[model samples]
Target: MSTISSASSSTTTASRPTARNLGPKPQDNRIPVTPAVLRGIFASSRTPLEERSISRVAFFRFTGFLLSCLGIAWAAARGRGIKNSAALLGVV
Candidate 1:
């Protein structure tokens, strides 16, 4: 019983994470911008960037594509639920 407990405790301690084991904390001065967050910011009606950069323009196009996909998906799902072919094709 003692040996089993000691082994379990050692394993738990070894599995525990240290600061260096993980990436920078939220409080860190420098944090990298993720693509999802950047795209989301641009997808908003009002964007902060005045001058267009590569990332900004790319995200703009991506946002448009995503919006269109969502619209089409919504229409398709609605059509399926309501059993309306016209709505599925977005005719109405």
Candidate 2:
């Protein structure tokens, strides 16, 4: 039993030095940016003028759809007086 316990303790002590050396040691400050990475980031940052025009059209279409939906919901709720008059009815 004493020999087994000593062997296990020695193995544990041997691993501590290797575990401490396995981590980053403050000298790994290198940027790995290639041309492909730079081009990808640049292309995604700003759209071209033609693409901007298409995006503007899509934006207005989506805005109009959203406004129409909001108007329908507002008119329906106003007709029912559920959202506004519920507070007065003590159901809120």
Candidate 3:
């Protein structure tokens, strides 16, 4: 009984997460695009859009962003200000 109590008392609680103990920071794999890079990408014929899938991926991502923005605007306008059906139609 004394040995069990001693063993339990000897065990330490888990330490909190510290910067040193925690593993290395997570890496972001995405390439950041600037306006100049975008202009170069669009203007340069050297870029083989056919050879890569990045264009298609970018197109869908951009389309989704636009749609989400539109939905948010519609919700904000209708949720608070618009009450009547005619006003809602006008908003649409």
Best by TM-score: 2
lDDT of each: 0.79, 0.80, 0.73
Estimate, for each residue in 1-92, the C-alpha lDDT of model 3 and write its tens digit: 99988777666333446567877556656678999889787657555755356678889999999999989878976777876666756766
* Residue 7, candidate 2: C-alpha displacement in angstroms: 64
lDDT of 2 by residue, 1-92 (tens): 99999999999988776654787766687668899889767768777985678779999999999999988877777777766756535678
Q: Predictions ranked by TM-score, top down?
A: 2, 3, 1
Q: Which 10 residues in a row give candidate 1 its minimum summed lDDT?
A: 45-54
Model 1, position 28, has a per-residue lDDT of: 84
TM-score of each: 0.31, 0.39, 0.36
The TM-score measured for candidate 3 stands at 0.36
lDDT comparison, 1 vs 3, better candidate: 1
RMSD of each: 10.6, 7.1, 9.8
lDDT of 3 at 14: 35
lDDT of 2 at 3: 100
> Clashing residue pairs in candidate 3, if any?
none
